[model samples]
Target: MEKRLLGVIDATAFHEGLQELTLHRSPAAIPFGGRYRLIDFVLSNMVNSGIQSVAIFPKYQYRSLMDHLGSGRNWDLNRKRDGLFFFPSPRLDHPVTGVGPLDHFAANIDFFKRSEQEYTLITNACTIFNTHFFPVLEWHIASGCDITAIRKGGVSLGMYLLKTSLLRELIETRHETGYLSVRDAATDPNSPLSLCSYPYEGYAAMIDSVDTYFSASMDLFEPEVWNQLFPRERPILTKVKDEPPTRYAREAYVHNTMVANGGLIEGTVENSIIARGVKIGKGAVVRNCIIMQKSKIEENCIVEGAILDKDVKVERGAHIKASGKKPYVVRKGTVQGAWMNS
Candidate 1:
């Protein structure tokens, strides 16, 4: 069953308003939901659908992406045959606006040609959602189209389920000036490719901008969105870490916060999402914030409507807030001192 379907993760497809999150990594590598990278959602979707053969082609700043996905063992994508493949991660320079996943497909044409899977699923790595692809694949097989793409929220998620031979043809002919964007090729009226749409009703979030990222994080405060993402039947998979339980001191006053494993909390946290291994000292106040892994909020500091990237440090008594509008993002590995305004 696994060999019949191939999964492709185009790691460089989308990045806009994500300058802060993508400074050191691609958009797919952006951390979300406290414990999972943005790509984890799509990868989990692929694996949970019973597809074993997965190939990921990441663009520049892909080391972190590689480190995170590893061999895809956590998703049970590790096998001698029809297993996970981390394609050649070449560092590339492009126009200021950058190109789409066309390059990814062009470079991996050999892989597409070699795979035995009858159908291929290609997706960008920046969408946050939980969905099973098997049903969609079945519909695609029945529809008899060359491609069946998931359409929701007035936008195609850059997710396509295609016949393997058709995809190979697209890639082989991609050198033509007009065929670079897969969307254009699929939708062209004169083209021989038969493209159709598959409706998707599941909860989905496409993170193209910083505002979307922040909003999606806060959306977790709603039980519905949280349940949609962290569904009981299929879990979002990521690389595991070995750390002790989060230790909360008696002084910790946490309310309405989703704190991951292995942290030390001794502060006032309300309406915030705290990642694993974070430290909130006594007297610190965090409100409406998303704190990433291993960040530290010292005593007396106040963070409101902000996002703390991984390994950030906020010195004592500092203040960073968005005033109920924009959310200030503390870039990865930033260290703010006593006097700070953001």
Candidate 2:
């Protein structure tokens, strides 16, 4: 069956360190893994899974995102049937008030209505992981599930797969009511139908749960709010294996290593993730960090848990680590442990 995956590029700066870097740009444009941008991970996953049509939802600060993801050329996403399309937020004439994933998805409800595919996969942009989505789609269909949420076991990677019809129903119901949280829809027994949580356990569990199926519950949301919806005997639980060694950066440094040119990396390092034209002096030790394009690191500098914006400089013997959790730069000969937010 023809299947289309909709990769939603949500632009919220969810991480403190990443938010600072994306002050001028969208989070999707944040550089990661030495060479690739954060959005590359999600986009690449879609491409690798043979999903041709993809739309990026850029809500705020999208210029850089637009620049990097130009026509989706880099990931072979440029074609007659396949290419990256940008979907902007609905205007006042459209008047979409609240902001949430469902709202964003509702704004682009027309895309779903027009799509010819039988299955649709919705994923967030910020998560960094590698998986072929076709299997997830297959599991969704085989289970006779109306909605199948793709969840990682240990830590939620925040992905899901739902039937096009179910998504349409959710959007329509929420649009009439002016609110939609996955927590609310999955629990209401009086609603259209129940949902199935596909536990991403080991290979056997993955196959069995897809075959047997289980009910979805409010466990997916905050515990305090559980009473707002109905409770189920045992909600479906998917066990997802640990993703690749992924890092989320708050304040970090990296130097002179090859980053695979896509995704996010957190923490500090020296002589690692160094793309072309990056220079680090002999005495410079970069610890817990991310370095982007052509940035230079100077000598005798002890840099710790800091993100060096492009072309940032640190002179000799400058010890720089900031506390208020913002990525800051240290000029020449400056020995400071904390920085004042300007």
Candidate 3:
């Protein structure tokens, strides 16, 4: 059954609310959980589910995403037979919409036609969850539904499972059917196709805005949430770099924070998520913050309830604070000087 499934990810989403982060890359490539990209969760889930063939359709800025996923080797998807496939959209003017836009899929229709998979699992690239699709396949098959929409608490999770033949039909007749994407066909109440809902009880979070992203990042501090998403049996995979273990100074004090590899901590940190290769200089206080890779918070700086993107620098004695729910976002590779504290 796993061999019959093909995983398709739509990585073209551009959320206006997350423009600060998406200015340089697609939302799918946004860093998350200190060490993983947003696409890692779903991509890893597909690989873990024994789906050998996976295709990603991306648009807008996707260089970072391609770099992070590189040959799909970390996930063991670099195969000569059926492995990772990348199709970039040619329609630059096409509006970015929900999962599996028929227009985008139509651009690479030949790949779909040549594939041997009987069923296709379509999903968005930015949702965070840890679950296999085998059970959903069983439910769809048993229910005799043409499409199964994976839901949690009656809300669509932007995941769909349907026959490959039906998907091709929808793509071919999208203009006539008035369905712009697979999400459209599966979600429309007046559609003629049979639809089923599969309720997933596990924890799921969709990152559509800075607030939601911050909330989800902070949630990792909870043991239950962390355990559910990072279970040993089905671990979330990411690009691995052989960086030295994080180094901590004797004066450094940390509690309730998730710090990634190759970081140097020399300050007081609490309830934050610090990504790879970050540095917190002596006497700095970072609380309730999300600091991305290689960001440096220099001496005596006080940062609270903020998100510093990769390569950001905070000059000495700078004070940055904002609401935890709505974090103050510092864009990638920017600098925060002491004067900005005014």
Model 1, 1-342: lDDT tens digits are 577789888776546588988888888888888888999999998888888899887766888998998877898877888778987444366421222356666666788888999988888888888999988988998998887878896578878888788777777766774666566665677877787899989788889899999888889888898889988798999989988989998998999988899999998999999999999999999999999999999999998888999999999998887755788888999998665445
Off by over 4 Å in 3: 339-342
Give the TM-score (vs. native) of candidate 3: 0.98
TM-score per prediction, in order, is: 0.94, 0.67, 0.98
lDDT of 2 by residue, 250-338 (tens): 54455444443323334345533443334555566665454455555565666654556565655556676645543344322233332
The Cα local distance difference test for each model comes to: 0.83, 0.53, 0.92
Best by TM-score: 3
**Mind sharing the TM-score for model 1?**
0.94
Q: Please report how far candidate 1 places residue 219 from its true position, in Å.
A: 1.1
